[model samples]
Target: MRDVLGKLGAFAGALLAVAGVIAVASFVIGLLSGRVSFGGLLVAVVGAALIAGVARLGKVPSLLGGYSALVYLGLFLPIVIVVIYAFNSGRYVTVWGGFSTASFSRALHDDAITSSILRSFRIGLTTSIVSTLLGTAAALALARARAGVRTPAEVVILLTVVVPEVVIAIATLIFFVNVGFELGTTTMFLGHCVFNVSLVTLIVRARFLSMGDSLEEASRDLGAGPISTFWQVTLPRLAPAILAGGLLAFTFSFDDVVISNFTSGAGHETWPLHILSALRFGLTPTLNAAATLMIGVTLVGLALAALALRIGSRQGAADFSTSTT
Candidate 1:
């Protein structure tokens, strides 16, 4: 009897979730059509309440699944809109201008956009390199340090990451100004490296800690010097983590707007800065095309990072298994 009730509760929760989704979709459509959707909103709210109540009755998985779907939808909906409207035939981004790829052509032909893109890429590349090298060194040092030193160092490093980015940006800007440094691409690059080094350090440190020093010991035992062992054994194993961290740093630098805004002095613009400046005038499909292209690049970078991490994990497991055998 309890099983039957549980099954029935699950079914009811599923129905409520479905109804809520349909109502939300209708609400969105009505909003797009320039109409207020009070009735649809009410239905969605009521459906959500019902689902929650069912969840309290032990249908939690169904409720959680629906919630997860909603969360993802909220997160990706705007990105989906931007990508879809990139091809809009209309000049403005919001209106349905029919499907056309002219915006992409315009974006490509625009010198300002192209130049900003190149500048961003250069800054991102430079930031990634600096972050990777410094972060790797920090990770190596921390791993060998005493607990007292490691704890303090880790707290300092994490503080750089956990502190608000706006604060970092403002602090970096003030410091540069006080030091009489010119704000330009160089400043922007330095600002990015500040936090990115911490990010890369955490990633590499995690990988380094998980990767035991047995392999390095083996190489040393076979008459390999520290430098030789690091080059031959340590580097090969650590490459995936380094690559993943670098890719992530590059992506963060590429997408950053706050630091770039604060540090990029007059006359120097990255792609994100360019987009912000363009937005003051109005939304254009060309901007949408550019954003869509950036989204594609970001997605590719993230995918590659995830793949590298997965590969590293698998390789580590294989190596551990071989050593144990």
Candidate 2:
């Protein structure tokens, strides 16, 4: 009887969730179609309430189901707003004069904007790859090193995160000047690498620490060479963390304004820099379109990274627990 009740409660919750999703989808569709109504929103709210009530019946603790619904809505609301505004046919960014694709068309056709976007992409991709490699190696080295050596290295790695980004930018600028190097995409790539490497290191290090050394040691004991063990055993386990860190680095590089400002040369503006410059003259619908695209890309990258980390960390924990048992 208890099992049947629990199953029924969960099924009821699932049905409510489906209804809420349908209602939300209808509301979004209404926005795009210029037919937004209060009815869809009311249905969504009622569905959410029913879902939460069902969750309570199913033994979920602390109103977690309700909190989860709210949290997801909060996170996605801004994106939806930006997307809706991106299609605005107005000269101003925020005003909803009408629905049109002119903003996207204008943004896509602008050579300066497109070029800056391409440059940012190149810098971001290169930085992500290089930083991930360097950071992952450093993390592995630290994990395998003696405590005395690891302590100082860990401190150095963390200092970049603790220091102000402007300080790092200034230092990078001065260093480049001292070395007689010109500021450009190369300089921007290098500057981004400095910060991103630290970020990757932190993420990969946590993954490494959680994974522990048991599997690696076992591989070696079973007559595998260190290179082989790392390639076959360690790399596979670390793949998700590396990918997550790389995506994070790419996102950071793409969104950067302050550091890129110091490192970018004359006539070599990144997308963020371009957007900032445009904002000086007040925001436009075209700018909103560009920003909306950027936000979409960034959110996708972050979502993927978060999913990778979550899955990888959970799998690692399960493996470790099973091994110990």
Candidate 3:
């Protein structure tokens, strides 16, 4: 009976996938002809959902792959559009003129854009540094702390990350205003640090927990002092996690718009804020170029962070194996 049901579900999933592909193709063709195909889009969406449901029920790998591809297309299509349009020679963002790098050149030469980009970079760098230092210290303390103390600390850290950014932005704004602190780069820096510190702490703590204390214990047993053991043993092993956390913090800080909007004072527009302001008039290919550049930087940061974490994990495994031997 189970085999019969699975076969039936797989057949249904296959039919739905075929329908979805046809609908999607029709929608794309309509889009290219400047026609809105809501019916086709609706059909595609419904088909995709049905196929996914059937795949889940039947354990059909092909159906699941089809659904995942559709989902990825929806998510990345806009990014693809933006990147393609960055090379557009036309003044407007949506219209396709001939392909050229003029937009990038213009964006680079624009003083306001350049200044905003630099300001964001500076803020992100500062935020990452502060967050990494404070977070690493907190993680170390938590590792040694009693459960009663560590539990609350962990909850607070998680709250900082999980709380709505809009709420954090509004609250930070209110606090700064109430205290008579001027909103500008300083406030933005501080606001970014508030949450970024939590991100770093969580990452470092996870790495530290997985690392265990065997190496540190061995160092201590070898007649090394507390500080010596930390510098020679713990610090070296913790470095990759620290670097990963810092990169992640920097990416978040650079991409932050909600917190930056609330905290940035007059004349201190970050790159995102600058883009927002430019939207009042109209979007240009230059903005697309700027966005593409930002996207590239963000991707690079995230990639580096992942690489660092991977390296750290391997190092930890090697260290553990050696210690055991």
lDDT of each: 0.86, 0.84, 0.86
Per residue, candidate 2 scores C-alpha lDDT tens digits across 88-119 of 98756777789998888888898888999999
Q: On residues 208-297, what C-alpha lDDT tens digit does candidate 3 reach at each position?
A: 999999988899999999889878988888898888799888888988899999989789999889999999988888898988987897
Candidate 2 lowest-lDDT run of ten: 58-67
Better of 2 and 3 by TM-score: 3
Best to worst by TM-score, what's the order?
1, 3, 2
The true-versus-predicted C-alpha distance at residue 188 of model 1, in Å, is 0.7
Worst lDDT run of 10 residues, candidate 1, spans: 50-59
Model 1 accuracy (lDDT, Cα): 0.86
